[model samples]
Target: MSALKLAIVGGASTYTPELIDGFARLRDTLPIGELVLIDPAADRLELIAALARRIFARQGHHATVTTTTDTTTGVHDADAVLLQLRVGGQAARDKDETWPLECGCVGQETTGAGGLAKALRTVPVVLDIAERVRAANPHAWIVDFTNPVGIVTRALQSAGHKAVGLCNVAIGFQRKFATHLGVDPELVRLDHVGLNHLTWERGVTLLDTPDATTGTEVLPRLLTEHGQAIAADLHLPLPVIQRLGVVPSYYLRYFYQHDQVVKELQDKGSRAAEVAAIEKQLLELYADPALDTKPELLGQRGGAFYSEAAVQLIASLLGTDHRTTVQVVNTRNDGILPFLPDDAVIEVPATVDATGVRPLPQRPLEPLYAGLIASVTAYEHLALDAALHGGRDRVFDALLAHPLIGQIDLADHLTDRLLAHNRHHLNWA
Candidate 1:
């Protein structure tokens, strides 16, 4: 087999180095050569190229590195492409979270106004990259690692690209739940279903065990007892356990918002101001001319986070010896659950390889939980249609279909307000 060529977009999201580190860490286990890095910004690309070369040189491995501002040049002949491009990254995320708070609406990372903002900015860019991949390397598998992942991934898929969105939050919550219950996350079976940032934990238990207690199970008891409070104490943006109960937190903004908590923040000052301050600090660090002098500050910092786990999962599927401990993956439903949609994005255990992803089968959600999941899938499909066709009515129907949005006569109100407020920003307009 030839050495796999990996292409990474958005070379400056701070995720670049970690992914390089992930591939490099597995160099002894799996052969990866010729990393191609692409971004429109030259300075960031230079920094990333320098860092990657230094790391490769240290291991006495000769890795061909390609840096380009052009997508076609970078992605052509690649085996896999990881899309990490952010329309604006943290600066935009803060705006998304702060804008709704300013309007007395629930500002969030993945729902309502903030999500709408991100979708508008993200759709065009993601599609552009997807199209380039199609034109350049028709066989490459594209893994999208962007926020509002359900929306973006759906867009790429509907546009007829082989793509799946990736988020580490689910894996994080699963491990925490396992720790709380004194069980291995791998052994626990999860009947999880929902939209990207908003999913429900319809059911959970040991994968193979003699029938025992129900609510008396350790996982459920732990969640019911200290889940919400722990989330609060941690200041976690999403209430993983509280919103989905036994399910992993799929960006909780879709189901619940602690209005009081947000109100308190507003009462004190502006959340956007806080974001600006953080941005200033990051920008200063990024702009410092002396960063090259400090070895520690030259590349991605902090030990391995879950984002790298996605790559390891892919390596496992490819039959590499570099297997990961745990991974959260999206795979097609092949009757594992009779109730859930066959094409719905599922959170399940998977093994990956050059052949493709293989998801383990699990039980179905309860009827009521399945219905909730259906509603979210409906929104995902419709929103994807709207993004692809530029149809206002489809977008309207998606808002109408959402349980929370539909309950509040949100279709007309949200559509009109967004049409008027974001006419200039929206790609559809």
Candidate 2:
């Protein structure tokens, strides 16, 4: 087989080295001859490229590390393209996180009115990049790890691009649960279902285990044996998990307790600021040529297990992995959830391969979960529309449809704040 090439669209990000390390660690799974880091910021790209090279060298791999500011040049002839671009950067994210607080809403990058703002700014930019990737290498797979993943992935697919959205949330949980079960993560198969960032692990089956048989449901054991720990992870009370008999994704806190989250955000300040500080520190660390491994501080920056997830998905997509892999990805519903529209992008466990992704059949979801999924699907529809066509009414409708901002007054306030913070990015604004 010929050596493969991969491109990272937002290669200047400090997070790029973590991915580079993954490529080195999982070298057998996804071999590469050249790795291109594409970014507009030449300064950060230079630093990131140096660190990426050092990481591969430390691992004794010869993947060529290259940097480019031109999208077409960077992605040309690549086998896979990874999109992690942050349109308008952290300065913009600061506004997205702070303005929503004034409206008494959780200022978030991917879950509320703030998320809507990010979608508006991000979708068009990402679509253009996808187009460039398509032109450069039509066969190249687009792996998106961008924020507002469902919206971004849906946009790429809607434009007839070959794309799959990857997130670390499900894998992070899989690893966490595996540690609790005293088993390897590969043996854990999570019944992870829902839209990106919004999901639940209803059933966990151990594929290979002595204490339990394959396909055995162990959600109860996870909750009962490690209820407090699980609850702490999601920030939900033990009583909630006990009553539901399932583990909700951490993002659920924003929906299950919207007002409380708003109060907390108001007091705690924005997460972006904290991440900004962390990124600053990481970049400084990345500049140190001696530092070849991913720092422990990267854990605090979130996206745990991102490298592993990306490697697994890319390996499956490239047909290099021999066995069929079941994993969570953000892709079209196609009846995966009977309640959602067929075109709505959903994050659920699917059979991944070079041919394409096929969502597994799931048992009917309880109304408690199904109802919100439906409502959120509706909100996502409006959110995409709002992102594709910039208008105050479209923004208003999306916010109103969101369960977190259903009230007319709140939606109105949120729409204004979103547009105001993101006007420069929105062409129609």
Candidate 3:
């Protein structure tokens, strides 16, 4: 097989170097002949591309790195396209993290009312980009890393694009569990299930080997021995995990502790502000000619372990290693969960290889978790509807359906605020 040509749609992002480092370190897994960074921000794009070249050189990898503002040119003949673009950038994210708090909702980028705003702004743009990728290379896979992943990915698949959504949550948990178990990270497999941000670790298994298909279930042991540490990592009470017999995603804090999270968010500055400051520092660091590795500061910038996750998924999708691996990915449900529609995009452990992703069979979901998953799944359907077709009522209905803002009056207030802040991006508004 020939070397792969991969394109990153939002390659100018501060997160690019992390990916560059992964590609450099994992060269044997996913060999690339060329990497095209596509972004409208020309200045940042150049800075990131220069650093990417330096990182590759430092690792003695010879893949050519290129930058372009033209989407069609960048993605032309690519084997896979990765979407990481933020629609309105940090300023819009700041709004997404703050405005919802005014109405007593948890202010977050990928949950509740604010998530709906992001979905409204992002879905249309991603679809347009997917079209370009499809036109350029009909067989190229589209890997979505955008916010509100569940809704955005659903839209892509619903439109019949070869798309799959990915998140760092599962990998992050796997790494943490490996540290606790004193085992190789690759040997740990999680029974990770649910929607994008909303997911749980139903079982933690230690594979006999890295590529083994069966493993010993160790979730009960982990909970018994290191439950407190795990709970601390999630910032949830240890009793909660013990009671449910599953570990919830940290994002579930927004739902499990709604009022308290709202209060905390109200008291603190937006995460976007912190990221903006970090980006400024990272850009300055990137400007240094002597720097050849991703800075320590970038780790604090978030998206931890994103590069590894992207590399593994891309390699598996391209069949570079010719091994079918079960990874937690966001893909079509197809009866993985009896409760959701087949078209609904779900985050669960799935078999991934060159052919495509297929959701693996899962143990039945308990009502406690299933109810919230079903509720959010319905909200996601509505969110996609509002994103595809634009209207105030559509936005209102999506927000209303969200478990975080089911109250009519609260949805009313959030709808007006959302449209007000996003009118510039929303053509219909």
Candidate 4:
């Protein structure tokens, strides 16, 4: 097979090296001839590109790494363009993680009022980039890794762009389950269902092999054996997982234990602040000519196993792997979740291949999970609307619809604070 060309739109991100590491290590899965790192931050872009090239060289991979600030130029003729954007960067995220505390809500980048703020700031920019990618290479697939992925991906697909959203949550669970089962990670398949971030692993199947179609259901055994360990990892009690007979995404804590989480968030510095500090250290490390490998500190920067998830998704989408694989992705519901509208973007296990992603059929969800999923799905629709056509009223409506901020008074306060904190990023604010 001829080598493919790939692009990373937010290549200046500290996350770039993790991706580079994946491309270098998984060269057989997805061969690339050229990689264009596109970002407006020229200085950081060059630093990341230089490190990326060194990483490729260290791994004996011959891919040429390039950098550009122009989206069209960077994405030209690309087979796949990965979006890892942060519209207003960490400074905006710091506010997203803080201001919502005033309303006694969980302040997070990908949920609640803070997530709505991020969507409003991010959707327009991503749409513009997607248009440029479409203009340059209409056949190229857009793999979105941006946060509040459900909404952003909905925007991309609603605009009729060929796009899918990828997240590490499912893959992270797979790895953990694999370790517990003492099997290879590839042998573990999760019945991961629900919207992005708001998902639960209803089942864990131990496949006969990496490519096997049949497997033994091991969720009951997993809960019986590693329940405490798993619960500790999620920071939720074992009873919660046992009571539901499923492991909820760690993000669910923002909803399940909203008040407690708010107090914890209020008492601590924002995750954005912590990541900003890590990025600083990472950049310093990247600047080292001798540093060809991703530093240890990068592990703590989050998005664990993202590179593997991304490479697998891109490889499958481009047909480079030539094998049908089931991976959890955010794509159009299209009736996968009977409770959601067909157009709503959902994060669930799906079969990915060159033809595109088709969400796997799922068993019915009980009202406990279904109710929240329906509520958040509604908020996501309104959030996309507010992102597409910016206005204070639309923003308030989205916040009001969010399960975490359903109260009128809290939504009002959050709406004003969100607008105030993000006015510079929102054109119509």
What TM-score does candidate 3 get on C-alpha atoms?
Answer: 0.99
lDDT of 1 by residue, 1-429 (tens): 557788889875454656666566667555677889999888778776776766666666677877999998999988778887767666666666665565455666566655665776778888989899999888888887776787787677667787766766565555666666677665554555555665555555664442222222355665676666546634554355555455435345335455664676467654445655644444455454444322444232322344455566555544554443334565554565566566656555554555666665555565655676677777766666666666567667766775556734556666665565456657567
TM-score of each: 0.77, 0.98, 0.99, 0.99
* Candidate 2 ranges beyond 4 A from true positions: 209-213
* Candidate 3, RMSD to the unseen true structure: 0.7
Candidate 4: segments with Cα more than 4 A from true spot: none
Error of 4 at 370 (Å): 0.6
The C-alpha stretches of model 1 lying farther than 4 A from their native spots are 55-62, 88-91, 174-193, 200-250, 261-280, 283-304, 317-326, 333-340, 407-413, 420-422, 425-427
Looking at model 3, which ten-residue stretch has the lowest summed lDDT? 260-269
Q: Local distance difference test, per candidate?
A: 0.63, 0.90, 0.94, 0.94
Clashing pairs in 2: none
So what's the TM-score on candidate 1? 0.77
Estimate, for each residue in 1-429, the C-alpha lDDT of model 4 and write its tens digit: 799999999999999999999999999999999999999999999999999999999999999999999998999999999999999899999999998887788889999988998999999999999999999999999999998899999999999999999999999999999999999999999999999999999999999988898899999999999999999999998997998999999999998999989988989979999999999999999999999999989999999999999999999999999999999999999998887899999999899999999999999998999999999999999999999998889998999999888988888899899989998888897
